[model samples]
Structures are given as structure tokens and as C-alpha cells.
Target chain A: MNRTFGEKVFNVFNLLFFLVFSIILLIPILYILQQSVDVGAVKSGLSLWPSDPSTAYYKMVLGDQGIYGPLLNSIYITVVGTTLSVLINAAAAYPMSRRDYKPNKFLVYYIVIIPMLFSGGQIPTFLVLKELGLLNTLAVCFLPVLASGWNIVLIRNYYRSIPESLIEAAKIDGAGEFYIFGRIILPLSKPVIAAISLFTGVGLWNTFTPALMYNSDPTKYTFAVKLREMIVVQEDMSRQFEAMMQQMALSSASGQAMTNEGLSAAMMIISIIPIIIVYPFLQKHFASGLMVGSVKG
Target chain B: MERKLIGKKKGGRLGTTNIVLTLMVLPAVILLTIFHYLPLPGVAIAFAKYNIGGFQEWVGFENFQYIFKLNNFWRAFLNNWMYVALNYVFIFPSSIILAILFNEVRIRPYKKFVQTISTLPHFLSWAVVGGIWMLLLSPSNGYINQIIEALGGEPIYFFANNTTFPLLYTVIAIWKSVGYNSIIYLAALSGIGLELYEAAAIDGAGRWKQTLHITLPGLKPTILVMFVLSFASILNLFEPLYVLSNAMVRESSMVLDTYIFQSGIMQGRYDISTAMGLFKSTISLVLVLASNFLSKRLTEDGQSIL
Candidate 1:
């Protein structure tokens, strides 16, 4: 079809809007990267471009006695948590997807509605975790959120799309439920699994509230909690510095050594790197098919 | 006779196997039962005069009475409603628009680039976003204000001003979430049948008219589901406000989640906080059910949620 002049104008305007929006979106990320590299630039004042850039902050963040411990903690939780969650959710979803499974509808409703409608508030959940001796433990970070209703729903929806004839044929081969699930279902279910894994992985990696609520130990802090501490502590430190500067003008020392902006930017850049690495790999699953498949079912 | 005995044994084995299947799901079931279901009864603590390190003294409905009497709770409730309304009115629609615009771009590389840049903010913790926002919105030396001065306008201290804080919070929330939320809508848009658009075009419908009649309607189910879900969890907004809020905007910024967080965690007033939480949850539950009912009545397919 031939495009009209008005259509052409609209398309051009849309392109311009997208371009400007994209630039606006990227500025913060770029600013962070610049701050992370240019210590002197930040110390002097904020600069759009670093005159002399270095990897000193990167070295510090990655080295021992740095925030690397918490980074590793986040990674461990995300990996183990995503794997276990996907497995459990997939297993439960498989039987439920089968038409012949007894009490299927009720089970689906029970799993779906309970988490959505009702949740125990944080205090009692905390008390329960404490009673279970999960407090101050790394397991606490992943365990409570392991069986998500949304994930179960998503997996079940995906499983429903698989042809029933495939399962029926496997059953006719005298295969047990486990064999059909292992040999037939898991292989056919890779795309949905990948999608759910990415969703759960990002969720676990970025989760801070549970970490704060459950684990008070600094050593057990995930990357997210440490990032919060860094940002909040930096704000606190800057306020202190301001107060100190006000008092010090009446006293001897004229020079201040640290700036909060650089530290905060450094910490932000550090916290974001893991997500950046994982995000591109998972980006494909978030494209149209994943949701369409489930929604159609 | 031997074959019959073996078949009987196998039948018994299958019965035990089903029990094992049930057992396999036990860990999740047990954790959920304890952590999720157990705390429900504690919602009653909202009614009683809850005391820490003390015995079972039940002063019925006293906590609820106190909550109703408190001016701060009312203010917080109003503030929460404003925040939620702003989110729904602006941020939600903006996300759908962004998704449609994103879908219209045919250039593969440019689309990916835009998608990546836009979604980057969603990955940052609210603390980091707050920190960046603080720098950007700083009364002095803020990049945004600096640009405003360069353009010969007065610099605005957004976070410090109560009137602008809600708008600021809403914009930042949209900036962070629009990309992530749009992915779902984009997924919906992609599933739309191309033949419908072709059919519309053949009927002399323009792009705008086609979108009005076809694209928007095609996206209605997803839009409705998302809106209902967003409404259900409106009171759960905590991270952004908690991170961005300061003394300047404190009066306007206190929402249900932040209030609960402060009372329960910071002040160690567990009972009042739990009461407030129960109140919020009850409202959310009602909203979810009402929205689901509404959706079921309006749509032929019924609601996908619940």
C-alpha cells in the first residue's frame, strides 16, 4: 500500500518521539557509567564527560573486602532459587494440565486464588520464618518466594497448549506419569521454562525487602540490600559531611576528602552489571510469543 | 496365577506412587501453609489491644477505633489513593502508548536499542533510582535544573515541594516501569490478527480509525487484565515512595505501605501496623473480586485473571 503525506508525517513524528525518549532513558545509565569511571571529575563537581577515566572503582567493588560477597550471595540465590522454582512449578503444572487428572480444577483454583487473594502480613511470616530457624540464613531469601502463584499459572497455561495426543500416546506406551513428564513434557516445554526462569531469576536477583526482613546479618546481605545500604549510607554520610563542612569552616582543616555522588554512582553501576549481563540472554523470551501462548490457552 | 499376583502388587505400587506424587509437592505446600495461611489469623490482632511481651488481653475493636480516630491514617489513606489514581491515570496509559509506538517501529535494530534503553531502569533497585533522581532533581546542581537555567527558566525543587512530589513520583514510576509493563501489552499487540487490519484498510479505514476500531479493541483483554491486576495491588506500592520520600514531601508522601513499614518495622508498633495492613489487604481483596466480576460481566471470554 502507498503511504499518504499525513501518514508519512505521523510516522516521522513517531520516530522522533521514540528517539528523544530513548535518549532520555539512556542519560541516567550513561551518567552512572561516567561517574563510576571518573573519580576526579565527580570530586571537582559533576561532569557530563570524564576528562580522565579509570577502572579504580570497578577494582574496588570487585576486590575482596568489597561488595563482591553480597554480589555472589545474590547470584547464588538467583540460580538456585530459579532452578528449584521452575522445577516445582513445572511438576505441579504438568499433572494439572492433564484432562484426566483427578481433582484438577479444584487444585488449579486452590493454587491460583490463595496467593492472589490472601497473604499473611510480614510480621507473622517473619515469626514463622524465625520459628523455622530460617532467619539470618541465605535460604530465607529464596524459600519464601519459591512457590509463586503467577509462575504456577504461567506454567500451567503453557502446559495446556501442548497437544493432549502427545501425552496420550506416551501413556499408551505403558509409560508412567514420571516417564511422560520427563521424556515428553520437559523437552516440549523449553521456551516457557526459559521465560519463567528469566522472570524468576531477575526477581530473585533484585529482591531486597525479604533480604532486609529476614536476614539482619551484614555478612549474609544480598547485592540488593548492600546497594540500599550504600545509597542510604551515602546520603547519611553526605549530610554528615555538610554538617562537618559547616562546622569546619570555623576550624583548621579546609579540605574534604570524599564526595557521596561518586560513591553512589559507583555502587549503582556495580549493582546493575549482573542484571545487564543476564537481561540480554532473557530478552528474547519476553518477545511476543511467551505471553501470547499462555494467553491463548 | 503368578501374573495375577504380580498385577495386584503393581496396583498397590501405583497407589503408593500417588502418595509420593503428593509428597513431592509437600515442601511448597508446607511453606505456603505456614507462612501465607498462618498469619491470616493474626489479622485479628488488628481488632484487639495488641501488646508486646504481654498476655492475652483482648480489648475488642480498640485498635480499629484508634486507627479511625488518627488523623495521620486518614491523611495516609488519601495520599495512597492519590498515588494509586495517578499511577493508573497516567503511568498505565503511557505504558500502553509506549508499547504501541514501540511496535510501530519497523527497524529491527532501532527497536531493540529503544527496548533495551527503556527497560534498563526497571533493573535498578528503587534505592539506585532514588539516588539518580535526587541528583537529577537536586534544587541546585541538578542536571535537569541546570538545563532549565540554560533554557532561561526557574529551577524547580521537585522533591522538596509537596504539590509537585506526587507528580514527580508518578513520572519516575512511569519512567522505570513503562518499558517493563509494555512488554506484556506488546505481547498482546503482536498476537493481533493482521488480516483484521487488512480488512479494515480495504473498507477505507485510516490508521487512526483502524486503531480505534481494531487495535484498541484487540488489546482490550490484555489492557483490562493488566488494569485489574494493577488495581488489586495498588496499595502494595512501597519501594519507590519509601526511597524517594523526604521530610519536605513527607505529608503528601505517606502511603499505606510506607505507613505500615514505618509503624511495624521502624517504630516497633506491630499491632497498629498489622491492623493497617489488614485494612489494606481487605480493600485489595474486595477490589480484586469486584474487578473480576465486572470483567466477567463485560467480556464474552470472561476474565483471564482469577
Candidate 2:
């Protein structure tokens, strides 16, 4: 393709524009990273370069059981919740996806879609969970979020693309519904399943509202809740640092020299590390899954 | 035996009458009923005096009347619309412009790298994003303020100031979502026919003219659908607002969702809070319906997102 002078100039502008925009976008996380590693006492600027880079903040964060408890809870909920969410939504969606299913329209519209549009609000939902005696339990973390209307919709959308003849053939061969679902439908729907799992996983990993509302026990808190408590709420970090110092048998002078900002930045990085790790590998699936789920909607 | 016979008679279209299929759907239905449908009637708590003992006094709209009288409620209500208006003016078209720019990129690797970095924030929870931004904007030792001090200007307290808080809110909101949101438009852009651009080019159209006449026109339906769908979230400003709000910025940042949370959970005024939730839900429903109606008018086939 032949490019005109104006087009060449525009291309140069666009490339430079994106270069600057990308840097601006990245500066926050990079700054946080720098802060986490910087050992300087009187740091007050945004420099991508760390001064006296040290792993002390990470070590302190890692050593603190306060961080570990929430970390473990977040991981547990994400793994278990994503699995159950995928299974429940997939199972429910399978029936709705069948072209011959009589109640598909009614169920999709009334039972699932209506609720998506008009929610019962937070207080009512909280009250319902309370009535069920689910508050403060690990079940509260995963159970309510297991079957979202959106996930079911996405799964059903993908399932609908599978040919009916495939299921009919399996049925004619004396294969049961469960066998066909397990063998044929599920194996063929890996893309959608992976997509929903990633979506659910990210959602569960980052969930704070559930922990905040349903669990009063500090031990039951997820990483998100703990993070909020530490950073956003500015819950006494000086005491937390003091506790760390005592645990380490470090002198009070060392504790006085260190600020909790570094520790907070370290925790923030730890919280998102899983996401950053899995993000590149799963990036393609996220976009494709969104597109697949968006079809005919 | 009977089930097999029935399946054979209907040529294997068992519908949901199949026991296995019904069983598969049972857990979801049960859970949805407990979590979603059950709380629906509980919205009535907005009208009644709620108690821990499961006793309710029929206050009959007293709660709604009470919240209506509160200055805070009105402020929060106005604040919700303010965010929505700002979103329209800035946040809405940002992704579209971003997608257009992304579409113009000739190099695959640079585009991919930029996209990866830009979309990273969307995966982060509001807690983490908010924490990072707060640190970056902190009045003391924050980078932005540090830069100001270096430049011989006063270090501004971005979050504490009502004026600067909204500006901060808008920038963060855009930064967080622009790349992720642009994916939809980029997908739409890919679907546009290359033949149209080629034909326009043959007809003495420059690259700019081709984009204007062919590319944008092709993306019209998608842009319209997205615009209409955005209305569904007009009042949904809880997460970002909750994470970023400080006491100093409360008057500017108080939104309906957080107001409900503060009043109901923290203050133990569940009744009035439920009333506020009810009001929010009602308006949200209206907005969704209104948007769907608008979508029907906007789309070429008169298709509604609902």
C-alpha cells in the first residue's frame, strides 16, 4: 500500500502518542514497584528507579501471618469458587442450550435475565445471607457467587453453538445425558469453560464486598478486605509494623526508619501477582471468550 | 425404560422434561431462588421497621419519607448523576478514540505491548487500584506532589479537594477501563469489510477519508449499542467511590450505593438504608428500560439489548 505524506506524518504522531500514553498508564504500577523496593527513608518523588533497592519490605510482608491468612483465604475461595461456578453454571446452561428444550425461553428470560436487570439490592441480599446463617463462613465467600446470571448466559450461548445432532447421536447410542454432557458437551466447550473460569477466578480473587458484608471475623477476611483495611482504611499500620518488629526481634530504631507505605505497596503487588502471572497466557482467551459470549446478544 | 421410549417417540428432543437435565438445572435454580429471588420480596424491608428478632412493624413508606428528607440522600443522588454525566463527557468516547488509534497501528508488537500494559489495571481490584492511586496522589511524599514541589509550585492535595477529587476520579476511571473497554470496539472494527476501504481508496479517497466514510460508518451499530448499554450503569458508582472517598471528600464522593452501606451497616439503620436501596433499584430499572427503548430506536434492525 502506498502511503501519502500526510498519512506518514499521522503514523509518526500516532506511534509517539501511544508511546507517551502507555508510559503514563504504566507509571502508577511502576511507581508502586519502585516504592516497594526503595530503602530510602525520605523518599518523596516518583522515580522509576529504586534507591538502595532492598527486599526487606517483601520479607516483612511475607513473614507477617496477617498477610498469609488473607492470602490463603483468597486462593482457596478463587480455586474452589471458580470450579463450582463453572460447574453449576455449565450444568444449568446445558439444559437451556438445547434447541428442543421447551422452557429455555421462559427460564432464560424470567429466572435468569430478569434478575440481571433488577437486583434485590445489597441490604436485602445481606439479610438473606444472614437468614441462611451463611455469614462469617467460608461458604459465604463462594456459595452466593457460584451461579451468576451472566456466567450462565455465557455458557448457554456457547453451548447453543454445539450441534444438536451430536447430542442426539449420543442419545441414540444408549449414552445417558450425564455421559453425553461429560464426554461430548464439556470436552467440546473448553474455550467457554476456560473463559468463565478465568472471569470467575479474577472476580473471586478480587472480591472484597463479600468479605466486608458477610464476614465480621478478621481471620475470615479475603486479601481484598485485608488490603482495604490496610491501605484504603489506613487502619493502624504503625502497630502492625511494631508487631512485625517485635516478631523479628529487630531494634525499634529499624522499625522507626521504615514506613508502612513500602509494606502496603508490597502487599498490593503480592495481591496482583497471580493475575499478572496468568494474564499473558490467558489474554487471548479473555477477548475470545468475551466475543463468543457476546454473539447474538 | 419409559424415559427411553418417550425419548424415541419424540425423536430424542426430550426438552427439560428429561430427569437428568432437570437435575442439572436444580442446583442453579435453588441457589438463584435463595440468593436472588428471595431477596426480591425482602426489598419490602424498605417500607417496614426491620428487627433482629424477625419482627417487622409496618411503617408504610415512613422509611422512604425519612431518606427523602435527608440532605445527605439528595447529595448522594446528585453525585451519582454527576459521575454519570462526567462519564458521558469523557469516559464514554475515550475507549472509542483509543480503539480507533489502536486500529491505525501498523506494527503488531508495539500495539500488543501497549495494549498489555494498558489493560493490566482492569484486572486489578478497586482496592489495589485505589491504594496505588492514593499513594501516587498522597499530599506528603506522593510523586505528583513531589513533582509540583520540584517545579516550585505548591504540592496539591488531590483527593481532599472537592474540585480536584472529581478530576482525579475521572482520570483514574479512564485509566482503569479505557483499554479493556476498547476491546469491544476493536472487535467491531475487525469485522468491518476491507473491501469497503479498498473501494473508497480506488475512488480517490485518502486514508483519512476512507476511515471517515468506510471505517466509522461500519462501526456505527456497535458504538450505538454500547452507548445505549452504558445507561444500565448510570447509578452503579459504588466500588471506585467507596475505595477513593475520604471524610474530607465525602460531600463530593457520596453515592447512593455507599450511602446505603454507611447508613444500613455502620449506623444500624437498615430500614432507611433499605429504602435508599429500593429507590436506587427502581431508578436503575427505569434506566435499563429506557436504554433498551433507545437501543430499539437506534439500531438498524431495531434490536434491543434486552
Candidate 3:
């Protein structure tokens, strides 16, 4: 199709705007990457690119005393938590999605509206968790948010879009409710399920607030809390630079080399790596699922 | 035959098994009820003088009166409004425009690249994103200030200056969300029958004309739904502000959610925070209901979000 001069100009302008915007989104990440790789550059000053790249910082983060346990703890919680959440959410959503279910619509609406309108506040939630004997436990991280209102709605909406005739055909073949749900509904709802799994997994993987509130036990700390401690400690060290420098004249101190910029960058990269690996596979469904669930009534 | 029919009717009676459906939903129901619904009664604490022991005495309307009297609350309220308004004004439109532009991209690899880069920020937690932004907006060696200086402008401390808070907040919000938000528009755009665009092209319509006449109109329902959803989240603005804000810009940066987090959780003033939360929720609920009502009135096909 032929385009007008004005149209061509507008397209050019659009391209330019997007190019600039995309760079704005990526540059910060690149800067962080540069900092994380260069211990020498961080010590000297900030630089756009690393002058002397080394894997030493990454080695320190990975093999550092007191870091590996929290890392393992985070991985364990995220994997177990995400799997349990997906199962419960799917199980609950599948039943609600059944055409003949009498309370489906009401239940769906109830779940959706509750999160939007009300909340008991943090203290009450903390109190409830405390009373349940789940505080500081890994189960506390997963169970409270098992069946998210948003995920349920998303899965239900996806189930609604499935052809009713397909379910009817399965039912006529003497399939029981559980059999039909497991064999037919679950298989057909893969995209939505995959989408929700990614969403829930990312949320659980990055969860910090619950860990902060519930798990006071240093042993129970997730990667997020551990990362926070690392960042905070490094920040404190940065603030005490003059004092540390003065102390350096008196005596060479061990563990005084920890800098805010390097450790924070390393932690940031570590926190993001798992999600980054998982994200691309589910990228297509991520936006579409969210839009469908969020924008649709 | 009559006996068989009678037997079937007796057997088909709604049994105890039906209540299992409610039982299945009970966990979420109970959790939300305890955590979400239970907070409603505590709104009463807002009216009472709250102490470590809980509401010590009935101080009817005193908390509300005090909140209204406080300059901090007013400043925070205005700041919250400004933040939401800026988001609606800029990010909302930008997403729509980006979706349209993205749709126009016919090259397969370029489309994938754009989509991949755009959605990266959504995965990064607010804390991490805030750190990145902190560096980016740093006065000495930050990329943004460097660019400003290179362009013959003064280096601006974007974060420290209260005046730039709204703009910075809006830009970061858009950067984080625009890609994610545009996917709906992209989906809506794709759902539009190609015949309309083809027919428009046949009628000598240019790209801009075809977009105006075909694409925008096709997106009307999606746009309406997005607008309603965005309005619903107006009070839900907390994470970015919480992470990025510092004391210097606190007056302009403090939002309703952050305010509640500080006053309610940090200070242990449950009554006041509950009141603030309840107030925010009430307004959001009303707005949602009103919008849904209006949507139903205006469009026959639109589902009522309420």
C-alpha cells in the first residue's frame, strides 16, 4: 500500500521515540551489569563500562559464608510454593468453571471483589498467621496466598472460553467430574495454566514482605531477605567510608572491602536470573493472560 | 414408570455433597474473610483512641478530625492525586500509542525484540528497579544527568527535587507498565477483522486515516475496560513510591498506600491506618460501581465489573 509523506514522517517519529524509550529501559540494566562484573571499577568510581572485568564478585556472592543457605531456602520455597499454589488454584478454578456448578458465578465474584475492596491490614494478617502456628515456617510463605483471586478469575475466564460441547461430549462418554476435569479441562487450559504458573512463580520467587514479617529466624530467611541484608550492610559500609578509611590507617580490617555498589548489583543479578530464565518462555501468554483477566469483567 | 420417576426424583435431591463446593472454597473464603473482611470493624478504631491495648476509649470522629486537620495528610492526598492523574494522563495514552505502533511492525524479529525488551522491567522487583533508577538519576555520574549536561542543560537531581517527583514517578511507572498494558490493546487490535482495514485501504485511506477510522474504533471496548480497571487501581499505587521515595521528596512522593503503611504498620496506629485504608477502599469501590453502572448504561455488550 502507498503511504503519504505525513504518514512516513509519523512512522519515523514513532520509531525514534520507541528506540529512545527502549534504550532508557535497557541502559540501567546494562549499567548494573557493568558494575557487578568489575570490583576494581566500583572501588575507583562509577563507570559506564567495566574497565577490568572479573568473576571474583560473582564467586564471592555464590560462595560467600551465610549466603548459600538463604539462596537454597528461596529456591525450595519458590518451587514448592509455586507448585502447590498452581494445584490448589487449578483445582478450585476447575470446579468453579463447571457449567452445572450452582455457585460458580457467585464464588468467582466473591473472590474477585474481596481483594479489591477489603483487607484486615497487616497486623491482623500477622496475628492470624501467628495464631495458626505457621509463622516463620516455609508453609507460611505459600499457604496464605495459595488461591489468588486474580489467578482463579484468569483460569475461570479461560475455562469459560473452552467449547461447552467438548465437555458435554466427554460427560456423555461416562466420564466422572474428577476424570473429566483432569483429562479434559486441565489439558485444554494449558495456556492459561502456564500463564498463571509463571505469574505465581515470579511472585513467590521474589516475595520479601511475608518473609520480612513472618520469618524473624535468620535460618528461615529467603533469598530476598538475605539480599536485603547484603544491600543494607553494604550501604552502611558505604556510609562509613571515611571512618573505615581512617581505621585502615590504624589497622587493616577484614570484611571492610564490601562495597554497596558491587554487592547490590550482584544481588540484583542473582534475584533476577531465575525469573529472566523463565520469563521468555511464557512471555507471549503473560501479557495476553493479564489483559484478558484484568480488562474483562 | 411412575415408580421409576418417583425414585429418580428422590435420589436427585440436593445432598450434603453439594455443600462440598462451598467447603472447597472455604479456605480462600475464610482467609479473605479474616484478613480482608475482619478489617472493616477495625475502621471503628479510627474513631477511637488507639493504644497498645487496642481502642482505649471512644473518641468519636476525633481521628478523622485530626487527620483532616493535619497538613501531612492534605499534602499526601494532593500528591497521591497528582501521581494518579499523571499516570492516567501520560502512561495510559503512551501504552495505547505503543500498542498501535507495535501492531504496525510487520517484521517478525523486530516485533519480538521490542516485546522482549519492553516487558523486562515488569519482572524486576520494585526494589531492584528503584536501585537502577537511583543510579540512572544520580547527579554525578548518572546517565540521565550526563545526557542533560551534554545537551547544554544543567544536571538535575531528579529524585531529590520535590518538583520532579510526579514526573519521575510517572515516567518510571510508564516504563515499567506500558509494555504490559499494551498487550491488551494489541490483543484487541488483532481481534479486529482485517477486512475493515483492507476495505479502508481500498477506499484510498492512508495509514493514519485507516488507524483513525478502523483501529481506534475497534479498540473502543478494550479502551473502556482498561480505563475502568485503571480507575480501580488508582488507590493501589504503593510499590514504586515505597521503594523510590526518600525524605527530601516525601511531601510530594507520599501516596495513600505508603501513608497507610507508615501510619498504620510502622507506627502501630491501627485505628488511623484502618480508617485511611477503608477510606481509600470505599472511594475505589464507589468509583468502580459508578463506572460499571455507566458502562452498562452506555454499552449493551459491556460487562459490569462490579
Candidate 4:
């Protein structure tokens, strides 16, 4: 329990380094939060504190019909997409994990592993989506991402670790495969399922290119695609703010003042809020899930 | 006689269980065939003359030849490898160093606080991350530039200046990923026996000496496996580059991913673009196979990491 002078110095330095490093990491997010509230620093320079703090930016982001369409699209896509992905991955993984199943080897190697190694790349995949008439639809957001080799592999590994005797006992009791999978395996596999759903949900929520590539219609854009347009593609976010203000003037309150920086910050934070809320609860699962995926199949 | 009996029982039970399990796996197979397997054959478009409408003609190796001839293709190809090498030098070991640092922390609550804040950025999409960095690095009124001006130094245009663009991009990439990547190393580090460190300490080993002899050597196998695994998807780094790059830094930022997207999707040069994609995929597959082979040779159990 005794420490040398060098050790003591190292500890002090480490603490200060992390203290500063943590602050540096948080600055962007903190700056955004501050900008979202403070109207006074709209045009320039970092503000440590909000001068004219208001909730108007949040209201603009939340209430505007312009943002609503994309928000609904994102919510529906993430919900449905994640559910379908988790279900399909679980179903696929369960069967593939069964040692007695004849096709398990072929399914694992040929069907899953081969595709993981080689892909037709962007154009071919885009073409396939187009051929299937999935382009420009909300379904495009989730359909192509429904089954991933990595997710299946992770889930299958989890399934493989489940005691085989449990399934055997169920089979002895005249339980069908579907019943065993639905009743026993699904419940037992909650941890893996939660992990997959959390990742898939986040991926779907942050989905950009699929929405960007497939959905040309402004009405069909996901929150990510819409936000990209608002913040990145269009240099002049102030014009969008003016348009929002005009719409607000007609729809609700007319006198409220909000800046482009405030609006952009609010938009970024709103998009990230779902993740922030869910992450703390499921972080351990995410870490464990990553390790599981990294393990040899 | 026992083997025959077991085979007979298996054959008998295969009827119902196999049918239901096959049915369960059917959806995935169908979806994979449509989405993943189907695109594989679509790589053939790289060899053909194609456009938005359809395949125009069979142009054997012409597209590949054209891609090879283009200076832009070579530039992107080189830039792609440069990024990978730079990642090896800068980005790859960052998480390991961070994990080691985290292990050094004695205060549990502070450790958790720092770790949580660090990992938050990983959840954000490149689009959002890009937006945040753009604001933070903006030349006119960016906080970084403001600080530089306050220090009586000239503000450098990070994204616009080709010289600073790659460095800035690497820094941003590390910031976003270092926390998340550290999770794996941290897991590995926790598995290293505390008894070894205690023994070393009892033998009059200092903290630095213990780390060098016990900690790092314990981490070696995990490091080896991770290194090989990383090679498999080295070319899969598209999203970050796509969201971050601009016209000004095109000279530095145009890697194979952005090249393929630009030529194939944006410009509708499907044939040449598909060729570029095929080239990228082929290299990625080679890297994957090579890494798998290396991992088998390197690991104690002689197992492939991928």
C-alpha cells in the first residue's frame, strides 16, 4: 500500500490529464447545449454560459411540421426495423446454432460467412434495392439492413452457449421446435436480443446513406437525412430558420426569436436524446455484445 | 453399432425439428439472398458497360483497365492505404493506451465518469459528429480558432487546408472511437491476473516495471487478435470520411470509398464505379483471408480470429 514519489507524481499527472481530457471531449457537446439556449452568441465565438437562455429553440425543433415528418419516419423505421431485425436474427441464429440441425454448417459457412467476406459493393446493392422496388420508400430504411452476418454470428454464439440439455428436455416433453424457440430460447436469449436490438436501433436511428440514396422525396427523409440537409449540406442554415420563423408566424407565436445556431444545436441534441437516454442503461450489454462478436465463430 | 443407432435416432428426429428450424431460418436465407448474395453477382457489372438504364455491353476488363489508368483512381488508392497505415500508427493503439490508463485509476467514480463521457460520441452518427466538428473547427468563429486568436497565433483552416485536413480528421476519428474501442482492450486488461502484479510488487518491482513486464505481455494475445481482425474491414471506413470530407480537402480526403460513391452513385458511372468497388472488395477479402491465416498462426490455440 506504500507508494514511491514517482508513483505519486504519476498519479497526480494522470488525474489532471484525464480531468482535462474529459473536459476537452465534452466541450463540443456542452457548446452545443449552450448554443441551443443562448441567442446572444448566435453569430460568433464560444460562450461559456448562455446570455439569453430560452427554450424557444427546442420548441421550434419539436413543434415544427417540417421536422415532424422526418421525426415520424425515423421513429417508425427505427421501431419496425429494429423489431424485424432482432426477430429475424434471433430466428436465424437459433436454428444455425443447433448441432443436430443438418443445414446449420452450410447456413453458417456458405450462406452467412461467404457474404461477409465478399460483397457486390454499393452500386450492386443499390441496384438490387431498385430492382425490388424498395427505392424511395420508408421500407428501404430497414429492409436491406434486416439481416447482418455479424449479428447472426453473435446471436448464434450466444445460443450455442445455452445448455443443450434444456432443449433436449423440452423436445422429450413433446414441445415443437417453434414452441421451444418462441417460449424457451427467446426468453433465455434476452441479453443477446437486447444487445442486438440496442445496436440495430441506434444504427437505424442514425441511418443516413440509405435514406440519402433511396429517398429523394423530402417528405420521406429520415431525421438523419433531414438534419444533414439542415446542418451540413446547406451552408446557409439561417435561411431555413427564416422559413421556420415564417411558418411559426402563421401557425403559432410570431414574436419568438431564435438563431440558426440555436436551432441547429437543438436539432442535433434532439436526434441524440434517444441514444443518451437508452445508453446508460444498456452500456454493459453493448460492451459484452462487442466481446461476444469478437470471439471466434 | 452405437454410432449406427445414434444416426438412426438422429434421422428419425430430423423430420419435425429440421422442418421447423428450416422454416425459422428461411426468412434470413431469403433476405440474405436478396440483399447480400444478390449484390455479389452484381459485381459482374464492373466488367460490363453499364449506365442508369441497364447494362449496355460486355466490356471484359475494360472498366478495370480504365480505372487503373486514371490518375484520380491511383490517388484515391494511395490515399486509402495511407489512411490505413496512419490508422495503424495513430488510431489503433490509442484504445490500448487508454485502457491501460483507465486500469491505473484508483478512484472508481471518477473512472466511470470519464469513461461514460468518452463513450458518448461513439453512439452519434458521422453526420452529427461531422456537424459538431464543423462548428468546433470553423475558421471564422470556431472555439478552436478563437483560442488560437486569443493566444496571438494565426488561426489555421483545419478542413480547408490540405496540410492540416488529414491531421484534423485523424484527431476527430480518434476522439469519436477511442472510448468505444477501449471497451475491448479494457475487457482484455481486466482478464490479466492481478496476482502477477502483486507478485511483481512483492519482488520489489515498481509500477512502471510491473506494467512493462506483466501488464503489456498479458495484453499481447488480445492485441494480436485485434490487429488481425482490424485488417478485415480496413476498407469499410466509408461513413466517417464521407460525412467529414469537403471539396477543399479533396486532394487529401478522396479515399477509395468516396471515390466509389462519387463515380458510381453521384455521377452515374456505374460501370467504372462498380469496378472501383470490386477492386476495393477484392482487396478487403484478400486482407480478411490473409489476416485469418495470420491469426491462426499467431494465436495459442491456432484459431482464426475472423
Query: Over the stretch B18-69, how does candidate 2's per-residue lDDT look in tens digits?
Result: 6778789888888888888889888888889985555468899898888889
Task: Say which docking band candidate 3 falls in.
Answer: acceptable
- The CAPRI quality class of candidate 2 comes to medium
Comparing 1 and 3 on DockQ, the stronger one: 1
* CA deviation > 4 Å runs, candidate 4: A41-47, A233-258, A287-297, B1-14
Candidate with the larger lDDT of 1 and 3: 1
Candidate 2 ranges with C-alpha deviation above 4 Å: A42-46, A233-256, A289-297, B1-8, B11-17, B51-54
Report the lDDT tens digits of candidate 3 across residue range B1-306. Answer: 543343243333343323444455666676666555654565666667774466588887877777888787777778777876787789889889989998887767767787889877877777677777776676655667777877888978788888888898888888887887788789889899989988988889888888898999888788877777767777766667866787788888887778877776567776666667666767777877787788777676757755
lDDT of 1 by residue, B1-306 (tens): 543343354444356435544555555566667667776787776766554553256767777788889888998999988987897789889988998878778889888888888876876777678878886766545667777777888988778889888999888888888887788888888889999989988998988898899888988898888877766677877877877888778898998888877777666676777788888888888988888888787788664566
TM-score for each predicted model, relative to the true structure: 0.90, 0.92, 0.87, 0.92
Docking class of 4: acceptable
Q: Looking at model 4 chain B, report the run of 10 residues with the lowest lDDT sum.
A: B1-10
> Which ranges of candidate 1 are over 4 A from the true structure?
A42-47, A62-66, A243-258, A291-297, B1-17, B152-156, B300-305
DockQ of each: 0.36, 0.50, 0.34, 0.48
Q: Which candidate is the best by DockQ?
A: 2
Task: State each model's CA lDDT, in order.
Answer: 0.75, 0.82, 0.72, 0.82
Each candidate: chain B TM-score: 0.92, 0.92, 0.90, 0.93
Instruction: Report per-candidate TM-score of chain A alone.
Output: 0.89, 0.87, 0.88, 0.86
The deviation in Å at residue B217 for candidate 3 is 1.9
